[model samples]
Target: MEFGVSTFITDEGIGAADLGRALEERDFDALFIAEHTHIPASRETPYPGGGELPRIYYRTLDPFVALTAVAAVTERLVVATGIALVIERDPITTAKEVASLDLISGGRMVFGVGAGWNREEMRNHGTDPATRGALMDERIRAMREIWTAETAEFHGEYVDFDPIYAWPKPVQQPHPPIYVGGESERAIARVAEYGGGWLPRGNVENLGDLVAKVRDRAGWRVPVTVYAARRDPAVIESYAAAGVDRTLFFLPTQPRDETLRTLDEFTELAKRHT
Candidate 1:
């Protein structure tokens, strides 16, 4: 399995270009960054990890801008959105941003997407929490249309548009690869329908079985990438043995020196599996 790093590239952490170069120098295959447009103060959405939300949740750099910087600085590292919240974004603008990033990066973009957990955050974006999944599905389909069609248009329940022109189609034909992020049956179904890969968190139950379930439901060999944020080498080895295509280790949000040290630690751990 290939190895990479994923993190909330925050304002306080290592800068994108420097971090990207360091990751490339360490032989990491990719750098996936997370995003959150804004955090609402009056929030009842408990974090998925079960505690107060981390400071990094509200402090991430815009994934496209950061990943673009990463792509500019590195030749081999794939710059990716670990889970760009499609539910909270406009499909047309997002589609253009993605295509432009893919073009600028010379085809090095992995569009990992998810319907997020923060209800308040989505609500602040004018997204109804109850119907966000359906909305996200429509948005993704619409984005696909925008990426591929010459006079792109989508008429869907949530996303609608007329035939419109979009420029700089991605270097990767038909658009960059998409990996759906979530640990739900609905997410698996989405993968079966449209995703090029699956991005499941590493700490889930019976991962081998879950991977099998996704592949079985898809009726094809879908590439599996575990977002192994727990930073445990043994579990990552288990993921590898279970036939995961790639595993991304968590890199903490810290200053450049601390970030580099963590990268070195992750690099050492990755050597066991990569």
Candidate 2:
């Protein structure tokens, strides 16, 4: 299985382009960056990781824009949104951004997405917290039309648009791979339906069973990619043996030298896996 780094690239860390080049240089297969438009100062949503929200969450660069830089500088690395908050953005505009990034990167974009956990943040974007799952589903469905059709339109409970022309359809036919990121059964079903792949976090329980279930439903059409996978070789090996297509280990947010030092360690882990 291929191995890579998944990170939150921020204003204070090693720049995205530099980090991307470093990953490619070390033979890492992909670079998956995280996203957060803005964190609400008054947010009551507990951090999913279960503690005070990390400073990185507030300092992240826009995933799409940072990835554009990453793509411009690296030739072979796959540039992706580790999990873009589709529930917090307009589908039409976001579609163009994804397609544009795909074109710019010569078809090497993976659209990893989720309905995020921050209720205040979602509200700030004019999205209702209660119905975000449906909103995310429809937005993704709508984006598919934008990427594929010359004149596309979609009418759904959450997304409604008339036929419109959007330039620069993605270089990858039908668009870049959409790796739905979550651990729920609904997420697994979504993969069977329209997802190009799956991006469940590596800590998920009963991962082997989930992998088997997804494969049974969609055959090889939906490959499983485990993100933020443990750095341990044994852990990564377990994922590979369970039929994971790729494992992206977490990279700590740090400046150039510190980041590179940690990357060297992860690179060694990748060497064993790759």
Q: Candidate 2 lDDT, tens digit per residue, 152-265? A: 999999899899998779999878999989878788788887789899998987888888888777666477789999877778778977889888889999999999999899
The TM-score values for the models, in the order shown, are: 0.97, 0.98
Stretches of candidate 1 exceeding 4 Å from the true structure? none
- The residue-by-residue lDDT of candidate 1 on 94-147, one tens digit each, is 999999999999999999999998999999999999999999999999999988
Predict model 1's lDDT versus the native: 0.90
For candidate 2, give the lDDT of residue 126: 93
Model 1 clashing residue pairs (backbone): none
lDDT of 2: 0.90
Worst 10 contiguous positions by lDDT, candidate 2: 215-224
